[model samples]
Target: MKCPNCQSENADTAKFCKKCGTALSKKSINHEEMINSMGNTKSGDNTTKIIIIALAIIAVVLAGAFAYMFMSGDSGANDSTSNTAPAAKNTTKVNDNQEKTASSEKTAQPTKTSMSILGGSFSTGSADADKTYAQIYVGKENAGTDVIVQIYYSRDGNSLNNGNMVPATVHNDGYLYITSADAYLYYPDHATINLYDSSSNLMDTQSVSLSPRSGTQTF
Candidate 1:
């Protein structure tokens, strides 16, 4: 051992220094104990510092994960909202198109009118036996209106004299009739009678055969 007061070397069993006559055992033991305590303190401080650093790193990682998850959830909600907006707009457009289609269908309906021809006949005139006459019966819709009749006569597939713009008159039977005594000199094998309204619009046409006088024509 070495004495602390005189810096002199001594035996391991000596309790006092030889040159300074000072105690050596207690001083050496105290110095060794102080060094051990300082080493333990340093070791404990290093361990605490490492644990604190590890905890800080863990806290930072957890915070970043939470923030990422929050951002992701928010982005998902925004995307859903954006997607729903277009769907709603599409639904509205479809509804508008359906309404427009229904409106067009309603407007495209045809109108109803009351204009028609009932029947007609071709016969010899009673007042003038040698002349032929045509009688056309019109519907009640032509009442109080002037009607014109045109006759197209054909004999043995040959076209003959045709009568046009023959005015009709209403009779006691509450119907309009067309009579033309000089419509044709000879009886026609086939005759087509065309009736026109007051505006000169062709209303109806009828084919008649005058070969058999006994045959009565009906609509």
Candidate 2:
């Protein structure tokens, strides 16, 4: 027989181990008990494995949920930012257009009156100091006509001042400029001016008492 305590060879009827002095029968291991212990260990190992697998699955699920939330939040923010960009640009464009239209309207405003005449007689402080000269200007509505206009200035009953008749030069926009300098050299008295066309057709005639504000006429 073998001693259970020291695995020593002994007599079959011996009750103790010769090498370690241990009682052989007391230290003997039962085959059934060892089998039961191994089974318990296998069961514990499987339980631990199942727990580890469950924890790993839970961790993976949590990570996926967190990633989904983060991605969703980031995507929403980007969408909001992109959506507002065009709206802001459109608002600015609308404001700019409105301002431009207001400016155009302001610039396009028309004049109040068509024409106004301003001229009068005045004394020249010169060698002819005592002599008062007459000046006249006639202003009226311009129809943009393509015709010549003449201003026949008569002083002392003659259409001559310094031996010349006042002629009005017509502009492209129908404005007339009296180009005769002698027209302003007449003495202040009763005078008549006749406006005639190129065909010698009388258009306007006015008689005036030459004074400071006597001939500021408008038509």
Candidate 3:
């Protein structure tokens, strides 16, 4: 037997320790119960450590997953922006090319040539009764010095003076005049004027009718 309050030897049949005067019992001296309690406590501590380790691992895994997702999202956004940038650039380039093509076509067109007779008149020489003259106000565009003007006279739709062409002389006031020296006419009632360019191409024509007058007249 052993004392419960203090470590001491006693007789197997003794109820109390002689050295310490402590009563001993079989239940108090049982070593197996103490060993079992120590084992249970150690097991509980191990279980707690395992739970904490598992929780830490789970937290680390979650953080890693979140970081990967964030990085992937950023990469996707960058890729989208890169792709859109090229498309926008290509669109702008195509628009510029189209505008340039239209501009070039417009620039390639040729200018038109124009010539016209603005006004005209008919006259007779006072000194010579058989001689008549014609005068016209000429307006022209892109014309040169080689441009020519001529006139033919008639009476009552009947050709006179054999439909002779009377060449005209240009004046500083933008008027062309046919002198008696060019053609001789006697009381002409109608006239035809023709204009030609340097290339001998007929540019314009005009007709005039003369009212009965004593001398010079405008038509």
Candidate 4:
């Protein structure tokens, strides 16, 4: 026999341990109790394992659901982008081609006039409410019996066509005048004045030139 309280060896008929005063029991009964306790412990272990497996399965299911939601949203965005990409590319190509074509256009030429200058001048003077005083001269005399002055500066893009001509004073072999104007006229110096016959035919068919002189205002 063995003492149950102290796990000590003892005589089979002993009611208590001789050395430690502990109770004794049969070996068969102890063995049976140990087997039963081992069975109960194994059952408890199985229950704990089942609980842990259930929690793991739930975690896996939640993770899979979240992954599905993320993938679906990403798929929708990709579909929208794919649909718009082709149109955006086409528009870019069209704009680039238009820019290249516009850049290749030809440049234009400018028109020129056949204007001749008889003489030009800048002098001191002023104008009234409707007219301005101008100075004009010619380097050579007209060959024809009579000559008329046609002061043709431009006004508003057309010939001054005031249709008025100032007659040369015909003095000292040089033509001089303090004329008037209602047209495009400026006198910084060297302005182009045209010489014409009474019928407005251009004179000085051979050649024409200008000379410089100082100016003064004559009331």
* lDDT (10s digit) by residue, model 1, range 115-169: 4557766665333224555566665544565667777777777766656677764
Query: What's the lDDT for residue 86 in model 3?
Result: 94
Clashing pairs in 1: none
Relative to the unseen true structure, what is the C-alpha lDDT of residue 174 in candidate 1, on a scale of 0 to 100?
A: 38
> Taking the tens digit of each residue's C-alpha lDDT, what string does model 2 give over 46-99?
999999999999999999999999999999999999999999999999999999
User: Candidate 1: which stretches are off by over 4 Å?
Assistant: 7-14, 30-33, 36-40, 110-115, 118-219
After superposition, the stretches of candidate 3 with alpha carbons farther than 4 Å from their true spots are: 1-23, 26-29, 110-113, 117-156, 159-204, 208-219
Q: Can you write out model 4's per-residue Cα lDDT over 117-211, one digit (the tens) per residue?
A: 34444443342123334444443442223455554433334443354666654334344454554423432222335555556667642221222
Would you give me the overall lDDT of model 4? Answer: 0.54
My TM-score estimates for the predictions, one after another, are 0.50, 0.44, 0.48, 0.29
Candidate 3 per-residue lDDT, tens place, 1-219, comes to 556666676777778789888877755654545777999999999999999999999999999999999999999999999999999999999999999999999889574344677887777755325577666777443323345666767777776655444444446676776664444444677778788764556778988888644377776
Superposition error at 181 for model 1 (Å): 17
**Stronger candidate by lDDT (2 vs 3):** 3
Q: Considering every candidate listed, which one attains the maximal TM-score?
A: 1
| TM-score of candidate 4 versus the correct structure, residues matched by position | 0.29
Output the lDDT of residue 19, model 2: 83
RMSD (Cα, Å) of model 2: 11.3
Question: How much lDDT does each candidate structure score?
Answer: 0.70, 0.55, 0.70, 0.54
